[model samples]
Target: MITDDKDFEAKSIIARMQRIDKWPLPPSFLAIIALGYFFTFYDVTDIGFAMPSIAPQFHLTGSESLFLALSIGLIGYVIGSFIIGYLADRYGRYPMLILTMILMALGSFGDAASVNLDMLIVFRFITGLGLGADLNLIPAYIGEFAPAEKRGHLAQITFFLGILGQAVTPFVALAIVPPFYYGWRVLFLIGGLIAVIAVVLRAELPRSPRWLIGHDQIKKADDVVSKFENYLKSNGETLPELKTDDINKINVQTETTRLSFLYLWQKPYRLRMLVFGLWWGLWYIGNYAFLGDAATILSDSGISLASSILFLAIGAIGYPIGAISSWAISDKFERKYIIFVGSILWLIGMLIFGSKANSIALIVGSFIASYSLAFLIGIAYMYTSESYPTRARTSGFAMGDGLGHIGGAIGALFLPLWVAEIGFFGGFAFIGITTLIAGIILVVGGSIATRQQLETISA
Candidate 1:
């Protein structure tokens, strides 16, 4: 009788934890995290806009020098993603998140104050560390908190909002850079300020209940779950009563096992990891090749710098549009199919952009390409976040995303050389061909995960 009573109690607690899906979306939490993501996008995309002004000041005239200057940050991304992601899994999510925000703010300030190319590269590397951590951590945080039914929508929404920060960069650059060439420094300063603000806002948010459970912090997890239930009650929602046998079943199965990287490579997970790694690597190669050098690409094709910025700003509209489209269809469609189709669209767009130097083609092609990339990113975030168990989720995402950064770094380094050697048409053709190959791999190997709980998907 006593054994039966204890089992029932444990099951009830577990059921309550799972019932977090019934709570209202916490606006306060989402808003604060979204703010951090905003600064991340702002800091990253601002560099592309600032590069033209920076190149003249530092006497960096060669394509190789410019590519190196731009891509040096990605080296830091690899380090931070691998190390910090492991730490987040070991320590806790909230602390690591706060630390990343502080690092980002400091790095942004350092970049704004840099006096030379070497100084700028060092600071950009530091900023990349924070950005990499954000990329790995934010999605995990969102995934753990969101309900299965709405998980894709919530994650995609946050990602799209971050892209809004990217969209805003060109307009801010155009407003600041031409009149005062030194205005690029001010952009970094503003980004730093935003990070500081996000830190303050995020301080109020709670740690992940799912993470607490994975770590054997049962009492703390229960407390957090109760808070979520209370929040729902305050919103006038009723709680469902759980059966004692259901609770007992959950209790019997509950065990805290330390998940390591080796575990991720075991049966069922290895194939998923491969698909994720390939998708991330291939997608970013094309994405960075185009956006990282938008201004330069346009200027090389005979457009004035001023006109190029305007075109980019116009093309930036696609970011939000793509984000919205992804949000609408994320829950409705299988993620693997969305990714496959988006990749194909991106390939087509790149081909058009590379086909001719006509201004109309450049503007339209860039828009389509940018839109398709953002759409793919939205779905990718949803898929990756849900693909791993809570214990190893951030680590899995970081490893795969780190691979993507490697590709982005390579693209940044070599795409310019490709352009110099074979012209814009050849450069974009390279992007198109690579993207098509990636899409084919995804179609062949990727798993479909739609409207399923994270635990169920991982299992």
Candidate 2:
């Protein structure tokens, strides 16, 4: 009957998407979504910078509590990703995106107002939930819209802004923390206020037509794609005609739109989850050891808190530089090679960082680490996002990066306990080794998508 016409239209919408050569959406829309990406990465290091100030305020008793103060939100991140990822997959990205941002605003504001360690832990967990979910959605959302060849370049534009947020945090802390009694509170308050702004911005973000098509919302999906087609046509661009095969692949995908997080364990998806999950865990374990504990290591090495912040700030310059570099290289090169090289450099940077506690070595080493890690993540995130399909992409991302916070938490906790005995070189060596393993594993597992349509790659 005519009831099946929706399926035909849904498939056509996807065909239109695959044919467009350039980004079909307005540039400003992507810019707004990029702000969400910025804040998510920003919060990753915000607590680490705030830790020195936070520790004394609550009279924290041990390294365990100290590291926990730094890493506790990760637990919230894991939980939030699961909740929002599922909701986004089942319902849609737009609503879940707003929910995630609201959680961050509440959590950030809550952390600022906290009077004790317990209250801070609670609020931080709330913030992590939003961060975990928002990050889980952002890449998948971007991946759906970006042309296959241009995917990496477009994604980097948002991630580049994000790295700058992380880089800017140290200076934000230096400006705020050293001067005011509750400068740390003000720093957190800033995260909350900006998150509120992001929530407002989310209202303008459109749902992925790809997502709608996958769920058989054909009329709506076609409506979105037609607008983009018209937009491109108005600009005098000629979109290529779609072959019949381009639309056929989606028919298999449409019989049941009941995909869930658990479905990731099925044949095609199981290996992806295992491989990408390990990569995320490994990446976080190493990166967290440095990012979560960089300030602590510096402070322990006889650098004053202000000086620790300053040195970190000096290295933060590399974050933006590396992000820009990745933007340039991501499309032209195979991502696997890029990942392998970034890790080797990341290890070298760690070695340099650990060579001495003095400013000369700290600044140089930190800059290298900062730069390489930025590139590593930018490339790796795109690589991982490319592995999954529209139906499960958000949850798949949540599974990889959200739960990867646990690995990060472990890395953050491990260094404080060991750094005192093995010294700086010893601690970083462990992280470097861990990072190298992740890059190697990446070569053998999951999808290695480059210049391929998402539908074809996922299939």
List lDDT for all candidates, in order: 0.79, 0.83
- What lDDT tens digits, residue by residue, belong to model 1 across residues 128-196? 888888888998888878877777888787878788898898899889976687798998999999999
Best by TM-score: 2
Which stretches of candidate 1 lie above 4 Å from their native place?
1-14, 20-25, 244-259
Displacement of residue 110 (Cα, Å) in model 2 is 0.8
lDDT of 2 by residue, 182-297 (tens): 99999999988889999998898778887777666777777888889998899899988887787766642542445577787787988988887887898788788788888977
Tell me how candidate 2 scores on lDDT.
0.83
TM-score of each: 0.93, 0.96
